[model samples]
Target: MELQVLVLRPIFFFFFFVFLTILQQSSSARVLTITKPDRHDYAASARWLVSQNSWGVLSTLSVDHKGAPFGNVVSFSDGLPEKGNGIPYFYLTTLDPTARNALKDQRASLAISESPLGTCTRDPMNPTCSKLTLTGKLLILEGGSEEAEVAKKALFTKHPEMMDWPKDHDFRFFKLEIIDIFLINWYGGAKPITVDEYLHAKSIKLASFL
Candidate 1:
């Protein structure tokens, strides 16, 4: 009886180990499959990515003798569409030459990226930065426009420090009428998304969160 008990104990332990190994592999496979984002979800993720960033690289065409690409760090605010509208937009205050050049060219791109926060250093192979580049026409608002007012309020709400600046400062309000947005997850392929598509995606995500 004693010998039989010992033999059964070894068999039970071996099966238990095998069962746990199979379970672990199954969970790992599910995780890998779930990480892929669909078109709509990718757009929503892009908007969420922009919302999380406060600073971004504003790329513009040079107005000087050389028609080079100029990039500058700028503080920006994302615009939420009106009650029924589903367009993606953003606003920023700029008086820099790059901004002027972009306005003249009417084409510009903003790259918003977020780095992982915490004490741990990021792995080089797997960077902690998530980026989204939004391409659009740069429109300057000088005179009174309802859209201008709405943009100003949104900007102030996000960055109250801008309110301390003098009213006559060369800093002017500029809006980016987003035509296409591309999100690169860890420097992957550029996923193209339209304004309406992004908004619709965002609505779905918000619903899920609620």
Candidate 2:
């Protein structure tokens, strides 16, 4: 019985270490994929918010409503997954009032919340939940431009269905030329992240195993 027990113990210990190794790899994968930037790092936090979200409220001066503020839920991408450039790109058609509004007046702001990312446990209105509003000029890209080509790839990769949308709808690519950034990630008032900081800051480089 003692000889049998000794032989089984080594096998059990070996398997136990194998299990731990597998578990560690799994946890590391989760951290690399979903880890959010520290809230105090305002620029990184802002970029993370923009990159993680696929859609947000894009507000523009309404052309049909006598210049009133118009907010429309729109899909946008900053870049390919985990490799965003901190500039929001959109596929829009003039048939949509939001796109028509942008043509008349380029001033716009995109508001995104941490709620959709599922990282916020508290009420979305809570300051700790984090929110970003990028105010900028919305400009359309000329067809076949180099920047337009890049924007198309970013949009299509993040939103594959966009590639299949009706081409006759006059959908064009537009980007937000961000001027001001308002971010609330913690308790105090909005963080004072400048446009340059937000754009040039090192974004969180979380690797995606998926």
Best candidate according to lDDT: 2
Score each candidate by Cα lDDT: 0.61, 0.90
Predicted candidate 2 versus true structure: per-residue lDDT over 149-186, tens digit per residue: 87999999888999999989999999999999999999
Task: List clashing residue pairs in candidate 1.
Answer: none
Off by over 4 Å in 2: 1-32
- Write the residue-wise lDDT of candidate 1 on 1-210 in tens digits: 999899999999999999999998866432221122343466756766555445677777888736788877777766432221223234444456766786679778887654522111455234334467788777787646887676677667657788887766566677777778877654456655677877666342222111
TM-scores, all models, native as reference:
0.65, 0.84
Tell how far residue 98 is off in model 1, in angstroms.
2.4
lDDT of 2: 0.90
